[model samples]
Target: MSTQKKAIVFLADGAEEMEFTISVDVLRRAKINVTVVGVSLKNDYATCSRGVKIIPDVKLERNTFKAEDYDALIVPGGAGGAKTLAEHETIQKLVMEFYEKKKIIAFVCAGTLVAKAAGVPHKHKVTSYPAGVREQLVNVYNYSEDRVVVDENVITSRGPGTTFLFALTIVENLIDVETSNTLRKEMLTHENL
Candidate 1:
């Protein structure tokens, strides 16, 4: 069987704009198929926390794509957005399905709580922006203050400030060091990386 890499990024009402855009950009640069899925009925338009309005490629409910069809699922962080995503039953089911299939599930900032809400917790290292949130996750997973943390199938990062690192790490995980390194230089993130 041929292996094809596809990814889905979930967008909520108040998602972190930078995290979402950076991830999609980096993943696409790595040649990974990326689908932006909105978690709201008004999926065509989502206003991020910082007042950036974004139009998702499609609504999650309307998308024909299934969990098994994608290699990874990425969730961006924004307190309101993460809470909305965590409370949604459909997103919860999707996350659980991905977890069961051993697919990559990534999150940034407050998005880590979505994983926790989905009942996917491991002792492996994980991280989020807020120190308090990190402290809370430490009880369930080995938490760190690092900018990016990848443990098994779970990948996480701090927040908007680390969006590049987070996206590059995702590329590294889904693609390869060579591809990620090349993109880093192209994106002028080589020094920071």
Candidate 2:
């Protein structure tokens, strides 16, 4: 039997391109199976924050995706995308289900706001985009200014610049530190970052 880990990335309109793309890229490089799910009911593609349109591998719907099927759930950030994710009832329920299943729930930049809306306990330490976004989550979570913060199965990171580390961190959690380190070296990310 194959032991490869599977992850699902939720994509909405205005998602941060780098966060979405890099997370998928790095996770695939680590040999993880990544399924991109479009949160939009209107189309199969999500128009990113910078106008990059990407067609997801699947559309999130009842009986289509489940928390038990994947090792992690990833949410990328953009102002509009985060708002959409935070407001979507199905997405919120999925977040809770992932939490209940003890699966990794990873968010980047403003995407961290979705955790607050989804009723994730506020005691966990987390970080987000440091400007206006941080203020909203400060009173709710044990907010930090660190580039990446991992509190148990929940992982959060800053903005686009921290995406590589954020994705690598997820890889570490799903696989192991040794695999993550090897990818870092192979990608020449070890010397650059």
User: Which is the leading candidate under TM-score?
Assistant: 2
Q: Give the CA lDDT, 0 to 100, for residue 43 in model 2.
A: 68
TM-score of 2: 0.96
TM-scores across all candidates?
0.93, 0.96
Residue 132's C-alpha lDDT in candidate 2? 78
Expressed as tens digits, the lDDT of each residue in 43-151 for candidate 2 is 6688899999999987776347788889999999999899999999989999989988999999999999999899999989999999879999999999899999999
Cα RMSDs, all models: 1.9, 1.4
Query: By lDDT, who's the top model here?
Result: 2
Relative to the unseen true structure, what is the C-alpha lDDT of residue 68 in candidate 2, on a scale of 0 to 100? 87
Q: Which pairs of residues clash in candidate 1, taking residues 3 or more apart in a chain or in different chains?
A: none
- Per-residue lDDT of candidate 1, residues 67-111 (tens digit): 789999999998878989999888888888987898899999999
Q: In angstroms, give how far residue 174 of model 2 lies from its true place.
A: 0.7
Residue 154, model 2: Cα distance from true site in angstroms: 0.5
- For all candidates, the clash counts are 0, 0
